[model samples]
Target: MSQVRVQPTADAIRAGARAIRRRNVEIVNAAGLGHIGGDLSAADILATLYLGVLNVDPDQPDDPERDRYIQSKGHASGVLYTTLAAAGFIPDSLLDTYMADGSPLNGHPDRNKVPGVETNTGPLGHGLPVAVGTAIAAKLDASPRRTYVLCGDGELQEGSNWEAIMAAGHRGLDNLVAIIDRNGLQQGARTEATNALDPLDAKFAAFGWAVRTVDGHDIDELLATFRAAPFERGRPSCVIAHTRKGRGVSFIEDRVEWHHKVPSAEQTAQAIEELSE
Candidate 1:
């Protein structure tokens, strides 16, 4: 039997994002490792997609007709795991075992082990290509299912993404939507300081994509943008969402060093306290 999926209100989804963030901090702190910065950066995006946009039935995870979502920014597994648990794709008990010995929850997501994950993706440039292929397959099957991928801005420097972008546009895979977490910071430094992706929208547009930029933290805007897919016919849509790394935490926000830093017990308490507010 398929689970009922009543879409949450935008405000409710926003609260869900906050809960996801708090859970993420707890699990990451307990596990002593996580890409927390990126996890925080993309929380709102993940929550908005799972709770209010995607047509997924957690109880029927392998529903062939369900929409496909690829966490292209896979290192941010903390956020994804929390979102999956919150969305009921996985049990909340599973979170306590994150990264434990023999735990199904690895540092990076594994499709074979995790429910709601469409494919295995951890290599920086791989997810978009897979999502493009998924979108193309849906088109060929005449399926209404759509494919959405979340890529980090830093990963866009990979040549393979452009190749996939070129292919998606050329094929006019209007069912495909690629959302870039434009947080500006990567693991080591600001994206511009490492390898700039400024003019990113123009770059995608040049490849025949219809592009729109939105504040990634804005739940209402995110819901509206994602549901209004295929912003133009005959073009894959790209939503470049501007976000702050380590969002919602005053000390860590936008600081590059926090990319994969494990928070101390005190910091974790503070982060949880702030997120609960």
Candidate 2:
């Protein structure tokens, strides 16, 4: 496999975004099922992080000094797997096996089977604690590694995340960054309707994290936010990325039905067409 050059140009990020969006549509279309809305919502953030910000090597996935990324909203495994493939952590051909009877790439992420995945995460609110542990380990070893965890806004309702958030701040883990994919919608309905987590920025601030809000789909803003480290001394960072579930495809955007709906052949074709352009 050939490696793409390591350069953080705007064009590269946009290309990665397009590739991930295209790959997500292909995987779901081929498997006949997936969390398409969540996958689409988090595509750009994953692309920017993996291609530009993350200090990972496809050739040496388990390198100790490498940065770590944990996907707490693991239902969007399609997005992560495709991003891994694009980053050369997995072969592009393996993507053909997604969601097959016995494929390693299941509907949710499994760290044991995947090379670059830092932890197995499917249950909401799990990755934050794991990420905190990883950061703590880095601090203990005096390692200069950074840890990032991307989670859904609805997942915030899980008490485990709050616990982890408190610990991250209490420990003064400035090497850690938690990104929330605040698409406003969850599995069934809007997060506001299911369990309101508004005033999310203030909540994080009160918890002791330096918080920032940005349009998640904007490549420039995403890159800038990731580059700007810990908003304050002796505090971890939190970026609340306001995103639209099913961002690229018009039919699926902001529609709760697309949360976990499998696109039919026609819908798939339309999605591919829209994303390609």
Per-candidate TM equals 0.98, 0.97
Cα deviation of 28, candidate 2, in Å: 0.5
Minimal lDDT window, size 10, model 1: 1-10
Assess the local accuracy of residue 227 in candidate 1 as a C-alpha lDDT between 0 and 100: 91
- What lDDT score goes with residue 165 in model 1? 100
Residue ranges of candidate 1 with Cα displaced over 4 Å:
1-4
In terms of lDDT, the best-performing candidate is 1
Residues 70-102 of candidate 2 have per-residue lDDT tens digits of: 999998999999999999899999999999998
Which stretches in model 2 have alpha-carbon errors above 4 Å?
1-5
Evaluate residue 184 in candidate 2 and report its C-alpha lDDT on the 0 to 100 scale: 96
lDDT of 2 at 111: 78
For residues 161-246, could you state the per-residue lDDT of candidate 1 as single tens digits? Answer: 99999999999999999999999998788899999898999999999999999999999999999999989998999999999999
